[model samples]
Target: MKASEIRELKDEEIVHEVRRLRRELYTLRSQAVTEKLENPRQFGVIRKDIARLLTEQTARRNQAKTAGAAE
Candidate 1:
């Protein structure tokens, strides 16, 4: 998923997407270990997507914290 698309998602939606991606990643890893994956590059793509979602979430959390602290 594109970072721009992810960033446009609501916070709750982003959390749900992260959970879904992690589950998919686990399934992909198991498939890779037991058999040949159709697309091994998917692993890297999922990982980066997860990272981007997490990064955006963290940034939002930190921004909230800083805003609260400033109040």
Candidate 2:
């Protein structure tokens, strides 16, 4: 998924997506070990998507913290 698409998801939805992606990544890894992976590039794509979601999650948390501190 694109960063903009990821940014549009709610925090909970983002978390869900991350979990789903992790599972997919795990499956891909297992397939790779068996040399059954059809697309080796998928690993990088999923990893990037997971990172993007986590980054967004962290940014939201930091924004919340700063906002609370400003009050």
Candidate 3:
């Protein structure tokens, strides 16, 4: 997933997407163990996506917290 796409997602959607990606990562790991993986690079790509989502999620949460505190 691209950073621009991630930025466009709602907060709830970000959480949902992260959960879905985690499941995919788990399955990919299982496939790798069984030597069934077609593209090993997918693992890195998914991990990066997960990180990006988490980063955005955290930033939003922090922004909200500061906004609430300032009010």
Candidate 4:
């Protein structure tokens, strides 16, 4: 998913996406170990996506903290 698309999601939705991605990553890794994975690059892609989601979540939290402090 694009960053813009991720940014449009609510915090709860973003968390859900994170969980879903983690599960997918686990499955992909298992497939790779079993020699059933056709494309190893999928693991890298999923890892990056998870990182992006995490970064966005952290940014949101920091923004909220700053906003609260300002208030």
Per-candidate clash tally: 0, 0, 0, 0
Worst 10 residues of 1 by lDDT: 1-10
Q: lDDT tens digits, residues 4-31, model 1?
A: 8988999999999999999999999999
Ranking by lDDT: 1, 3, 2, 4
- Residues 1-71, model 4: lDDT tens digits: 88998899999998999999999999988887887778888888888888989999999999999999999
Q: lDDT (0-100) at residue 64 of candidate 4?
A: 97
Q: What's the CA error at residue 21 for candidate 2, in Å?
A: 0.4
The sequence of per-residue lDDT tens digits that candidate 3 reaches over residues 1-71 is 89899999999999999999999999999988988789999999999999999999999999999999999
For model 4, give the 10-residue run with minimal summed lDDT. Answer: 29-38
Give the poorly placed runs of model 3, Cα more than 4 Å off: none
RMSD of each: 0.8, 0.8, 0.8, 0.8
lDDT scores for all predictions?
Answer: 0.96, 0.94, 0.95, 0.91
Positional deviation of residue 69's Cα in model 2 after best superposition, in angstroms: 0.6
Candidate 4 accuracy as TM-score: 0.93
